[model samples]
Target: MEQASRTVRGQGMSSIKEVVSSWSDVARLLRGGDSGALVPVVIPRDNRGLRWTTLVWFGLWALISGFMLLRGAWGPIAMVVAILSFILAALWWWRSSIVEIEEGTVGVLTKFGAISGPGLAPGRHYLWHPWARVAYVVDVTTEIPYAAPVLSSPTHENVPLKSIEFFLRFRIVDAIRFVQTIGAGNFDLVLSNSVQDAIRQRSRQVRTERAYDLRGSDVKDMQELLNRQLTRYGVQIMGCNIPDVQLPDQYREHLATRERVAKELVAYEKEWELTRKRRIDTLLMEIERSKKIRDAKIVEVKASLNKARKDVAQMLEERETEAQAIRYEIETQARTNLVAAQGEAKAQEQLATAYRDNRAVLGYELARRRLDVGANLAENAPRPVIVHTDAGSADNSALSTLLMAQLLPQIQAGAASRSRPALRQQPQPTGDEVAQAAGSAAQRAVQAVRGRQK
Candidate 1:
């Protein structure tokens, strides 16, 4: 409030000091400057026409009192009157002439009881003490808290509501109108009345059971309404709301009962949905199990069918092998019989041919038979001991003759023994006779063979 403010050329005046600084401003302010720099409210206690008169009177009064005190007045009443006049002039100078406004507070100035041009900014200012004065000081910056708790308001159905507590915060927007139109002392009544009226209108819009909707709901409409109604009075509603509401006891109990029923209905719906899902799942599982059983049975049947086919094929193969073996055995037996019969026929033909040729070869056959008999007879006779020697060795020949001589006796003994066997066989032939008989027989066989050759 003590800061010096800038004064520009065309911006006009911002302080009371500038308003009364010049002769023209002082003249205009004396003519009831109700059009500028102060609240528009009129006081009508002081007059603008007596602007010079009041100033001259104020100056004269102070001078006279000072002169009287300096001259040392003798009368007691005169001294007291002069002292009071000075005191009055001082009080007028301090309270009316000087305007000292604090920060956040707007100052309203009255020029001879008429509001000046506009609200005064925060700062100290000097004005015509006897004519202009600061009327009201208002804090325009801070918000004011207010509440209106209504009792027994009716709803749209005319259902009686218990209570509705309304809360808000407000601040001043127009300092001049706020202080002049509605002072701070009576503002609370106006605000409370407006709040009650708004609450009633809101309650009438909702049903009794839904009155709780008023609480904890965005109340922009209500707040806007209050702002419109109270705007002229310079009050700006910042935030307004219904913080609490109450219903009748019986209505509260009924709402609780309805809530419980609704909750039970929701629970039953969920349970039914779960049971249906479970039933579907169980049916699907049964179908799957049946499908698996059918597949297993089919596999078993196919396996058995394959086994039967394999067994049949094996039996057929065994029968075929046995048939082949029997055919082979039969063929082998027939071939053996055929071979044996053919051999016997060939042998008989050869034997008959040999008999037919036997008479033609009779002599040769007889000689061969005689030679064979003689060879057998010689082989059966006792062997003589003969000496072997080289032809050129006479001594060896002599020794051999001697050995022969010695062996002649033993040989004669062997011949005697042989003759005894011959005597027993009815006469043993002499050697020369045996030789002559064999020769005669050979000569006859030769003649017979030569005749046949011719």
Candidate 2:
């Protein structure tokens, strides 16, 4: 839409862009302009004026014509002047016979009030008859703008819009058909009607609430339709659009209120979303903290269990060592007691055998001593001598027990002393001598027995 308006607003015409350059061109376009709009191409002037160089050259041609008319008639000098003037004038007229049209314009020809040959291109041309001339000029290069505002057009909902402005640009393609059929001045009404109808039809298809959608929407279908209608008149719609659409004031106010409510709803939704995200983040942090605490507790429990197992193992080893030591001590004491018992039994048996042997030897020695005493008594008889022992006294029993134990050696010594002197004296003896000696000996034996009994 913006591009269309910019193009339409660019109506910058060139210096020679006068569609009505003269009164003849105006009469041809307004009154009898059906054939074409006419411009002077016969004289071959630019901007409808002669330049300085052309003016100077034209003065020389006037001097030649004057010399041809005023000089004497028959002299050789006059004849030569006439011949030179004729050549110069003929060349000058020949130069003027050539016609020219501008580069962007075309010229149509009409002779004796009838259409002649094809339109002349923009360059040098010559007319075969004096009656032939360029009857009109048509611009073929420029694009002209047309903007028409359709006011209070009815929509599909029967809602009449305030206004819809349509704009377009067009160029003349068939110059002869354009000048003969519909000239530039009359094409204004036809273009306005076409734009109004197209814009109202488009406005009808859109809802009243969506009227602004037409501002920059494509108008390709509408442009094609307009081209179909205006193509016979040699005009082509180069570009077109709906550049403006004005809605009712009451409807605009309603739209503004609806927009404010929609914005408020969007703001509340965003705030609620933020609050939900913050709560989710806090919960996640708490879950991580609890997991760390649980891991710490598990590590502590594992350490305590390992320590208890190590202590129990140490106690079991100490008890086993003590048990082994007690068993070894008991075995050593039992071996010592067994050896001591065997030695004591052997010593008691030896003591009893020695006691029996000594008793038998004492009995044999006493019997032998008794036999010697009897023999000596038989051989030597002594005069009657008596020695007695009282045997009933307790005192005598105790005295006999003591005398046997202490007086045996003393008795043996006394006998031996007495025998020593008898052996030194004579050997033979008489009855009295023998009797005396027998009496002594018997007395001594009685005394010895009495000592024993005492």
Best by lDDT: 1
Evaluated at residue 211, the lDDT of candidate 2 is 85
lDDT, residue 187, candidate 2 = 65
Best by TM-score: 2
Q: How far in Å is the alpha carbon of 77 misplaced in model 1? A: 23
Candidate 2 structure quality by residue, lDDT tens digits, 1-454:
5335434533321111125344234323322332232221212112322232354455565556557655554344544555565566556555644666666767777677565776888777876454566666666666655566777887778878877878787777887787678665556556667777887888889998788889989999999999999999888989988888887778667866876787887887788878888888888888888888888888888888877887787777777778877777776566545544444343344334434543454455456545645644553334332324566745556666676757655765676668656745744333455345545554454445444433
Q: After aligning candidate 1 to the native by TM-score, how far in Å is the CA of 107 from where it should be?
A: 1.2
Evaluate model 2: give its lDDT. Answer: 0.62
Q: How displaced is residue 211 in candidate 2, in Å?
A: 0.3
lDDT against the true structure, per candidate, is: 0.66, 0.62
Clash statistics: count for each candidate: 9, 4
162 Cα displacement, candidate 2 (Å) = 2.4
Clashing pairs in 1: 35-117, 36-116, 36-117, 36-118, 37-117, 37-118, 38-118, 43-113, 44-113
